[model samples]
Target: MGTLKNQVQLIGHVGQEPQVTVLENGKKVAKISLATNENYRDSKGEKQTNTDWHQLVAWGKIASLIEEYVFTGKEIAVQGKLTSRSYEDKEGVKRYVTEVIVSEILFLGGNGK
Candidate 1:
């Protein structure tokens, strides 16, 4: 039960190419956008599809794996934890963001590059 704290698992399509960056300390970090879709019927019984976008971040070995194989439209499964942070934007306004810090990944149904 303790290990379940803050855990998150998602299986979805990658929305864009991973943005990879290397810090001066030589650590690699990658960021990606994932889209999860749900289909349901509306109150009127009309079919509807809803899509939600998520922000994902990976570090070190996980980041390297993402850089090598994850790409736009790729389907993948990821397990991680949720984290949130705030920063001041260029406009000097406070910005808050939530992201999943990926710990594990599994490629699904695609010939990975």
Candidate 2:
């Protein structure tokens, strides 16, 4: 039960090349957008597709893997937990952001290029 707490799993296409940054301590972090699509039939029997974008973040070795292999349109699966943080922007306005902190990643669809 404890393991299931705050767990999130998503499989999607990478929206763009991962942005990897090295911290002042030489630790690496990576960020990317993933797009997931859902297809369904409308009331009129017409097919419709909805796409949702999610922000994903990775640290350490996971970030390194993303820096090397993850790219635009590549399909992958990630398991992580949702995290929210607030920060003040340059304009002095408080901003809140929600992101999935990736712990596990699986390359899918073969030859993830």
lDDT of each: 0.95, 0.96
Candidate 2 residues lying further than 4 Å off, grouped into runs, are none
Question: What is the alpha-carbon lDDT for the whole of candidate 2?
Answer: 0.96
Over 9-105, each residue of candidate 1 has an lDDT whose tens digit, in order, gives 9999999999999999999999999999999999999999999999999999999999999899999999999999999999999999999999999
State the RMSD for candidate 2.
Answer: 1.1
TM-score of 2: 0.94
Query: What's the true lDDT of residue 68 in model 1?
Result: 91
Q: Tens digit of lDDT per residue, candidate 2, span 28-52? A: 9999999999999999999999999
Model 1 TM-score on a 0 to 1 scale: 0.95
